[model samples]
Target: MRNPLDENKLEGHLRSVAAAGCQITLQDLEGYRPQTQPSTTSLEYESQYKLLVQRLVRSFSLEQLTQVLELYHLQPPPKPTKRKCARSIVEQEWNWPSLADVRRKKIDSEFSSQTFPLARHVSFLLLGKDGSQLRQLSLRHNVHVSFSDRPLSLKAEGLSGSLRLLEQDVKDFMAGITQETFALPVKRTISLASIQHISRTSGAFLETVDSQKLRIFYNKSHPHTLVLAKELIMQGLCQVTNLYI
Candidate 1:
C-alpha cells in the first residue's frame, strides 16, 4: 500500500484497486427509474368515484344530503326549509299473519278506532263486494291526521280484496291510497330480480320490486284483499329453498 498525497493521485490508486477486484455494473442514464404516476388510470378511477358520489348524492333528499355532506367535512347546499325534514315517524300499521280463508284471529275493523289501541299497527282488513277474497291494504296516518269521512269511490272494483279505480282517480289520490300507500299485489309468481333477502338490520325484505307490477285497484278498498305480492313470492322462495336443499 502506497500513500498518495495528492487528490488526483489518491483517486488513481483507488481506481486501480477497483479495476483489480470490483464487480460493479455501471448504471445507464437512460435506465434511470422514473417517478411518473399512472395519471390516466388514476383519473379514470377518480371519474368513477365522482360518478358514484353523484348517484348517492342524487338519491338523498336535500336535508339528508346536508347531514351527510357535513359529516364528511364537506360543504352542503343551502336548505330550502330550515325545519328538520327527517322522515316523519310514519306509524307502522298492524299486518295480518294469515289470509282471510285461514283467518283464525283477525283484527276487527268495526271498533277499529276503539278496539285497536289508539296508535298500534291497525290492520284494516276489507272484503270485496264480490265473494272472491279481497285484501285490504293500510293507508298511513291517523289521530292527528286530517280526518275525513269521505268515501273512496271507484267504479270498477276488479280483483277481490283490491281496489281498481279509474286512471284519473289514480292520479288524484296519488297522495293517499293513490298517494303513498304500500300494498303487495297477490302474484302467483316471483322473479329473482324482485324478492330480496331480508336484511339483518330491518329483519324485513322490503318488497319494492314487482310491487309496482301489482294491479292497482283505486277507490274505497278493503284490508283483507289488499295482500302483498310477497305473500305469493314467499311461496316461491320456499319452493326454491326446498329444491336447493
Candidate 2:
C-alpha cells in the first residue's frame, strides 16, 4: 500500500522547490501516491501548476510574451506590463504553445512596401541637402525609407494604409517642384508654333510677357522644382534658338 503521509511530504518538498524557482518535472511525482481524500491535495497541486506556468511565461521576451497572448486570442492587458500580460494569460486558462509555434503562425498582414524611381537631382531635393527632410518624412509617416544611389530610388516600408498616404505625398512633392517658371527674353522673332512644341515636350505652360518675352510655368510650388524647370526649358530654348539663329 502507498503511504499518503509520504505523498504529503513529497508535495511539500515540490512546493519548496517551486517557490525557489527550480523547475519541477513530471518525473519528480513518479513515486508519489494519490490521496483517497484528494480535494485538498488537488487544490494544492493546482496552485503549483499555475506557479510553474507563470515562471515559464516570465522566461519569454516581452515581444514573445505578447505574441503568445495574441496567439491565444486574449485581449491586451489594460496596463501592457509584462506581469499583467502574463497574469492575463494565466487567468484565461488558455493552453500555452511553444515559442516556435507561436512565431510560426505570427501574422504580418499590416506591413507593406513601396518604391519610387526618383531622379538624382530630385532625390537630393526630396531628401534635402542635409537629409533632414528624409528624417522628418519618416517620423511623420511612421515609415522607414531606404535610398539606392545606383538606381536613385526611394523605398518606403510600413503599414499598408500609411504607405498609400506616403505615396500620394511624394507624388505631390514632385509635382510641386516641377511647376517653376522660366523666363526667356525675346531677342529674335520666335515662332508661336515653336513655343507650343516646347510646351508639349517639356510639359510646361507658356505665357507671353507683353509680346516682349516668353515665360514657361511649371507646377511651381517648390524652389528646387523651379531650378529643374528652368533647366528643362533652357534645353528646349536652345533648340528654338538654333531654329531662328
Candidate 3:
C-alpha cells in the first residue's frame, strides 16, 4: 500500500477505515448486507435502519415492542403530568420513566422480590351486609411466567385466584357456592390487543379482554401476575384503568 499515513492522506484514510468498520458491524448485527455495494456514508446506514424499524412497527406485538424498547433504550412518549409542570422551573428536574417503562422496571423488581422466600399466600374474607360473612378467597398458587412475541401463555393451576368486583354485592351472591376448592388451572392465553382495561388490587385484579372479564394475581411473594400486567401496559396493549393498592 502507498504511504497512506502521510500527512496529507492520513485523516481521510482514517475516516474511510472507521466508516468501513461501522458498516461491517451494522451489517453483522442487523443481517443487512449492502445490496449493490458497501455503505460509504453514515446516511446509507441510517436509511437502512429507518426502513427496518418501519417494517418492525407494523407487526410488533406486546412482547416484540418491549424487546425493541429495551434493546434500543427507547421509551414511549411521556404523558403530560402536573408534576412535570411544577418541576419545569427548577434547573435540575426529576427525570422519570414513562408509564410503560415503569412496568418494565416492575417486572425486574417483582422478580427480585420473589427470591426473599417470605409468605406467599394471603386469604381474604368478604363480608356481607351488617358485617355478616360472605365468602373467603384464598390466594394460593405457585407462580411461573413464560413470555413470547404475541401471546402470553399462563400455564399452571389456580390462575383465577384473583377477583374482580364490577357490581356491588356480587361477592355476597357468590358466597352460596359450596365448592370445596377455588383452585383452578392457570392454563390460559392472553391477547394484549383484546384487553380494554386492567384493575389491580395490590396483588390481584380483574380486567376485560375480548369482551370477557378475567382475573389474575401474584401471590404474596410471586410477582408473575404483576410482571405480566406491567408488560401489557408498557407495550400499550392494555391500559390500567383502576388500581386499588
Better of 2 and 3 by TM-score: 2
lDDT of 3 by residue, 85-186 (tens): 212211111132233343444443342211111111211112212222222212222333222223322122222222122112233333422211112123
Clashes (candidate 1): 34
> Which candidate model has the greater TM-score, 1 or 2?
2
Model 2: weakest 10-residue lDDT segment is: 32-41
Candidate 1 whole-model C-alpha lDDT, 0 to 1: 0.29
What TM-score would each prediction reach against the true structure? 0.18, 0.32, 0.15
Candidate scoring better on TM-score of 1 and 3: 1
Candidate 3 residue 90 Cα shift, in angstroms, is 32
**Candidate 3 global TM-score:** 0.15
Clashes of each: 34, 5, 2
What is the model-wide C-alpha lDDT for candidate 2? 0.59
Model 1 — which ten-residue stretch has the worst lDDT?
87-96
lDDT, ranked from best to worst: 2, 3, 1
Model 2 residue runs over 4 Å out of place are 1-109, 179-219, 222-245
**Which stretches of model 3 miss by more than 4 angstroms?**
1-43, 67-245
Q: Give candidate 1 misplaced runs (Cα > 4 Å).
A: 1-168, 178-222, 225-228
Task: For candidate 2, write residues 56-159 as lDDT tens digits.
Answer: 44454445446656666778877677666666665463333433333333323378898989964457557653577688888888999999877889999998
By TM-score, the best candidate is: 2
